[model samples]
Target: MADVVRPSDRFRQGMATRRRVLGDAHVDRASGSATPFDQPFQEMITEGAWGTVWSRPGISPRERSMITIALLAALGHDEEVAMHVRATVNTGASREDITEALMHVAVYAGVPAANRAFKIAKHVFDRIDAGETGGGSHD
Candidate 1:
């Protein structure tokens, strides 16, 4: 017989944090679609990204959201940038805050990367303003 696996304390914390930041619908979609192949990846993010980094108290979720957006933008992670931008609703980050972060990204990362990120962010913001809560994956 296969033994059932209980989630760890860290995983629990991560799941809670993830849900709070990403929302129930997005988290539900991600959790529901997890296959055996990507299950470990999902677990790793829950335990690492959400549980460890995001759960830390030194910074606010708003700060983390801005930093995440900047990093994703700098790295040319278009989809992730949009996803995080959408998540700003729950993270308490304002559009002005995101614009400031992207401005920094332009100076530090590059014009091209920041420009593309700005376009993506604008599109997401437009959708959000239109009363549509869906922009990125499962959002």
Candidate 2:
């Protein structure tokens, strides 16, 4: 008989962590779109990144939020930048924190990237104020 595969505790932990950081609705959309082709890749990130790395101690979610925002902005990952900005609400990062991080991006990464990050962040905060989920459109 073939051995059956099961989810590891780390995967479960990652799922919980992902849900906490990304929110249930966002995670649910990702989960609902899972296919056989991407299942393994999804599981890998769930366990390795979310479960193992993000769930680690030392840095607070606040610190991680600042770091994540800067990295995402530096890389020009506009959508992820906005998403992480929304996560700041849970992470206790203020709008000032995000602005400061983007300032770092401007000096270290580039002005264009920081400019776009600022624009994206403003759109996200606006949507949030309009009572919308900071979900949708990574483009």
RMSD of each: 1.4, 2.1
Residues 9-110, candidate 1: write the lDDT tens digits: 999999999999988888888888889988898999999999999999999999999999999999998988999998999999999999999999999999
Error of 1 at 32 (Å): 1.0
lDDT of 2 at 122: 97
Scored by lDDT, model 1 comes in at 0.91
Alpha-carbon shift of residue 81 in model 2 (angstroms): 0.9
Runs of candidate 2 with Cα error greater than 4 angstroms are 1-3, 137-139
The per-model lDDT (C-alpha) reads 0.91, 0.86
Report the C-alpha displacement of residue 76, candidate 1, in angstroms: 0.5
lDDT of 2 at 105: 98
Q: What TM-score should be assigned to candidate 2? A: 0.91
State the lDDT of candidate 2 residue by residue for 1-139, as single tens digits: 9999888999999999888888888888787788998878888889997899889999988888899899999998887898888888777899999999999999999999999999999999998899888466321
